[model samples]
Target: MPFKTKILFLCTGNSCRSQMAEGFARALRSGDMEAYSAGVVRHGMNPLAVKAMAEAGVDISGQSSKTVDDLATKEFDWIITLCGHANENCPYFPGKARRIHAGFDDPPALAKAAATEEEALAHYRRVRDEIKAFVQGFDINAAG
Candidate 1:
């Protein structure tokens, strides 16, 4: 059997973007990759993120918000940063992990100034679909 690539998605908070990426990666590339997500700081899983994934038939409610420190001992084939903050502040990984920057807009931040819940959720949904598309088209073989 071919070995599955392990990937870690990082963000400032393990709330929206990173969580969405992990969910899509797992749902779309389970046979070729193992997906995990963490943040520089844990902000807990975003409810809107969970809701957005469910809309696309991927359930991410079981996933937890974790920190880079929590996965210190784990090794990954790739570490993808989903936000500028995480790309700048990512911790060292003691392995052959290749780092990639694929920054996505922060849904929570965009939603913060939203005038209504629907407007706020729109931000989450947009980012969620973007992340899903990125994950669906990820070049896992190139990581090798």
Candidate 2:
């Protein structure tokens, strides 16, 4: 049998980017990658993220927002941070878990400049697609 890489996607909050990455990894790389996501601090799930992902045919609505502490016993092969904040303050993990940064824009923060609801959601959609591309092209050997 082939080995599956256990991956953890992290960010400042469990609300958007990291959640989206987790959803995409599960939907696209379930065979090779075991994916989980968490935050340095919990900020609850973002509805806009769910809506954006639903449009992309990936449902992230059922995923919850949580902190790294929630995953105390779980170990990872790769710890990927989706924001500068989480990368700067990432916790120490035991064993051979390698940490990497894959930062993406904060959708809510970007949406602050939007003029309308659709415009705001555009930010979510764009970031969702960007994250999808990143997750889809993730090269395990390169990281390993």
Candidate 3:
């Protein structure tokens, strides 16, 4: 059997976009790929991110916020940037890991000052759907 792909989804903050991409990657790839999300700087997992994942039938409620420093020793087959800031500031990783940029808008930033909770959640939901589409369309074999 072919080895399962391992991926790390990164963003500036481990709050919304990366978290959503992680959830969507897991939901879409399941046993085919192991996906993790982390940030350049640590921030608590966004509540709306969890809610959005839950709505998509993926439970990311227990996933903790992790920093790139925290995962420095781990290796991944692919390191995917989920935001432009992350892509710009992405650190070098030792190993044969390849890098890819798949930028997404910061849903938490959009949600933070929204006039209503519904508006915030809706933004998160839309971001979550976009992540789902990206993950589902990713061709693992193209990683090489």
Candidate 4:
């Protein structure tokens, strides 16, 4: 019924952090924000990310993995980068989309040496919660 802020969560692969941000935003801030996510390049959805989000009662399995070029709309109120690669390589949007960088650790990379599935998932869970908190606490109006 009121104005919905448009946000784009950008990441390197669209596999984890950005997806988590988008999911958390959708589940937690849907009343006031329309969130979208994409990577500089598509790495497809990460299964571990899905599992981690499910554990938190959020479903991110329905979201897609694609490049920034894939989004139908280019305008956004905020373009938040969830990783360094995306932050450095983010494509320009012609609108008044204010950009912000909030880098998060890559779960898959962090779990690379993990000896077991549970160990690997630990990384996902941690990053997922971190992203959720960021999405919940971020003040879009604070961006300049």
Candidate 5:
């Protein structure tokens, strides 16, 4: 059997966008990839992110909020940053991990300004779908 590509999705907080990307990658590309997510600072998993992912048939409720420090010893094939803060502050990897920056908006921040619960969820859903599309379209084999 071939080895699976190891990927880590990173963001400012391991709460929303990165978590969603990790969930989507795990659900959609489990055959060729192993996905993990972490943040520069842990903000705990977002409930709205869980709901948004569940709406798309992918459950991310079980995933926890983790800081990049928690994954210090692990090696990854790719380190994908899902937010500008994480991209700019990404830690160094000891091995040959390739770093890629694909910034996504902070759903929580966007939703905070929303006047209604539905409006807040709309932001979460949009970012969720966008992250899903990005994860689904990722070429695992090509990363090598």
Candidate 6:
């Protein structure tokens, strides 16, 4: 059988955006693609990300934060960076990996800036839904 495409989503923190993207991609692509996420630093999975993904009907409660070093040996068909700073800082991944950047504002940072928890969750929901829509349309194989 042909190998399923492997995709790695990346962010600086591995907390919010990359995790959410992994959840979204799993929901949309399922067996068609293998989705993984990692960060430059292991900042732990963000609670807001879990909550936001739950609202989207995709449970990411089991995913953990991973560092780039942890994933150094794996080869991905695509490397998608979800934050602007991360996109700039991302190192080259060997193999035929096609790198793509789709930067989004950090929802956790927005939540921190908000006074109410409800307001923070609202921001996360918006970001989660937006990223879901964006990733749904990506054609990783064609981009290479």
Q: Please tell me which predicted candidate would have the highest TM-score against the true structure.
A: 4
- Model 2, residue 132: distance off in Å is 0.5
Compute each candidate's TM-score over C-alphas.
0.95, 0.96, 0.93, 0.97, 0.96, 0.94
Candidate 3, residue 86: Cα displacement in angstroms equals: 0.6
Native-vs-model 3 lDDT?
0.87
Candidate 3 local lDDT, 24-76, one digit each (tens):
88877976888888999988988888987898899989888999988888899
Best by lDDT: 2
For each candidate, the alpha-carbon lDDT, in order, equals 0.91, 0.94, 0.87, 0.92, 0.91, 0.89
Per-residue lDDT tens digits for candidate 2, residues 1-144, read: 679999999999899999999999999999999999999999999998999999999999999999999998998999999999999999998988988898899999999989998999999999999999999999876745
Off by over 4 Å in 1: none
Better of 1 and 2 by TM-score: 2
Give the alpha carbon lDDT tens digit for every residue of 1-144 in model 6.
Answer: 557789999999899999998998888887677899999889998887898899889999999999888999999999999998789999889888988888988998888888887889999998898889887887766855
lDDT of 1: 0.91
Residue 46's lDDT in candidate 5 = 95
Model 4: weakest 10-residue lDDT segment is 66-75
Model 2 quality (TM-score): 0.96
Output the better candidate (1/2) by lDDT. 2
> What are the candidates' C-alpha RMSDs?
1.3, 1.1, 1.4, 0.9, 1.3, 1.2
lDDT, residue 14, model 4: 93
Flag regions of model 2 displaced more than 4 Å.
Answer: none
Misplaced by over 4 Å in model 6 are: none
